[model samples]
Target chain A: MNRQNSNKNNDHRDDFPGSFRSNPFHVPDHYFDELPGRIKSRIEQDKSRKRLFYLRPVVQKALLAAAGLALLIGLAIALLHERNDVHVYIGQFNGISAPDIEATLLPSDLDEYTLVSFILETQDFTGMPSGTDITDEEIKSYLLETNNIEPLILHY
Target chain B: MHHSDEEIIPLIQDESTREKGFDRLVKAYQQEVYWLIRRMVIDHDDADDLTQDTFVKVWNNLDRFRGESALFTWIYRIATNEALAHLRKKRISFSFLALEKTSTAAIPEYNDAFYRSDNAMRQFQKALAELPDKQRLIFNMKYYDDLTYEQISEITGTSVGGLKATYHQAVKKIKKKLSLE
Candidate 1:
């Protein structure tokens, strides 16, 4: 099969009768004489390039990965610091009790239903308020002791 | 300066005589390797650059030679690889559109002073350029360089039978392109 193909190619070449095979390209004068020196210089230049700053692909990838890891760690640390700051600010009210939260609630902050529940939880069915000797602290204590009502209804 | 591989390998291995050995190797194989690359690239300048790259690789990697193949075959393999890599980087292919682009742009104009003024040669080059990269290499190795199928197989890592068939097909294609078929 190979011989047949070769013979066919030969016959084709014969039929063509003008297939030029000699090298048609020409180089600059003295190119061959100077090529060895050029190659040597290039090799030296590459060696210097390696010595200066050429990093292997593996090393470059590792450096990128390390940098990414460091950035992630830094962000995590920053988030934890912010979280700790919030904890510290909340801890500042250590001496206060739940009454302080209830004391800060505006009238607008409580709906009418909550107001009714509050009233039922705090006061007895003694109708409207009269000019009696009922202290605010006594009312609060009744709210706390009678129905186990939490004084802190307003969220922060 | 015509040192055999046995003589050149030792010089390359030795620290003192390495440069001298390499010089001889370049002198011995440079023309053959250059022409091989030249045929593949079809431009003298690109071929020149790739030829230098091939030798530089040879100089750096000659120490790894384990005598599995002839030194020249190893060098041919390196040269072939350099040429193919350059074409790949430049996105050159042997498709019809690619051939048109190469003929118009990549190939040095005949008006260039270094280009030969032979129309037949140019036509043959055009016919050769129409082949795919591997087929072109096979044709160049077998038809032009007169390398045996086994030697080409070593350089290209293709089986001998495959290379023979490829070479024959390449010839047919070139012949057809040249309007000889």
Candidate 2:
């Protein structure tokens, strides 16, 4: 099949007026002489380029990982400092009267809801009797003794 | 100086003789490779750059070349791909109308004393430059380079039948352009 095609192409070439196979282009004198040296230089340059090409991604990824680790460490340190501040502030209030501690530590502008939520979060209720175990009479007696009767009546 | 693939391959595979083998390879095939690219690009400078690029690829990939095909065939394949890629990039940078103008502009204007003597050859080159990149490639390989359709297929990764059709179309176009038909 290739032979047939080659023969056909030959016939096609015969139909042309002039030969196209002869190259009309000219190169500078000694172009071929210098080509090998130029190619060798190019190959050396390419080798250097490829070395940098392979190394660049590894360096970029290492830097990115290091940056990420630094950010996480920074966040953890900030969080630890914030927790320590809260602990030290509370520790300074030891032996102070409850009203005095509240007046000094809490802002006067704090809303009732915020104060209630804050007290609920900080107060320990582990040893307290369950609501189902408390009698109505006990609740009334505790409210009266604590002078919370007027507020309780108004809330009801 | 004129080393065949059989002699060249082993020397290139060895560490000590690799550069020498590569130099011999360049000397042996550089003109053919340059002309192959020159005809496609129509500019000597572009062809020179592409020829050097082709050899650089050959040097870099020689280690993985398992001698599956002839060395010239592999090298020709690389040159063909480089030429096509260069042409494609040129086309992309220009509008369709500008691409046509650029293709014609890329052809040297026959101002040289040698080129001025050959008006017919200049016309032939103009006709060839007017061809679409792949069609011109097929025509150049088949008509000018005297390559078999099978060899062209190996280089282009096109089926022989498809190459034959493209070659015929290219011939028809060139003939019409030259007033031969």
TM-score of each: 0.61, 0.64
Give per-residue CA lDDT, model 1, range A86-122, as digits (tens): 6574454445565674564443354545544555565
Largest lDDT belongs to which candidate? 2
User: Over the stretch B1-181, how does candidate 2's per-residue lDDT look in tens digits?
Assistant: 5667778878888879988888888988898799889878766888899999999999989888877877788999999999989988877231224544555445342333125447676566667777888898888877777788888888899999999999889878878978862
Question: Where's the lowest-lDDT run of ten residues in candidate 1 chain B?
Answer: B105-114
Which residue pairs clash within candidate 1? none
Per-candidate iRMS values, in order, are: 7.1, 5.2
All candidates' lDDT scores? 0.73, 0.75
- Fnat per model, in the order given? 0.38, 0.43
When only the first chain is scored, the TM-scores of the models are 0.34, 0.37
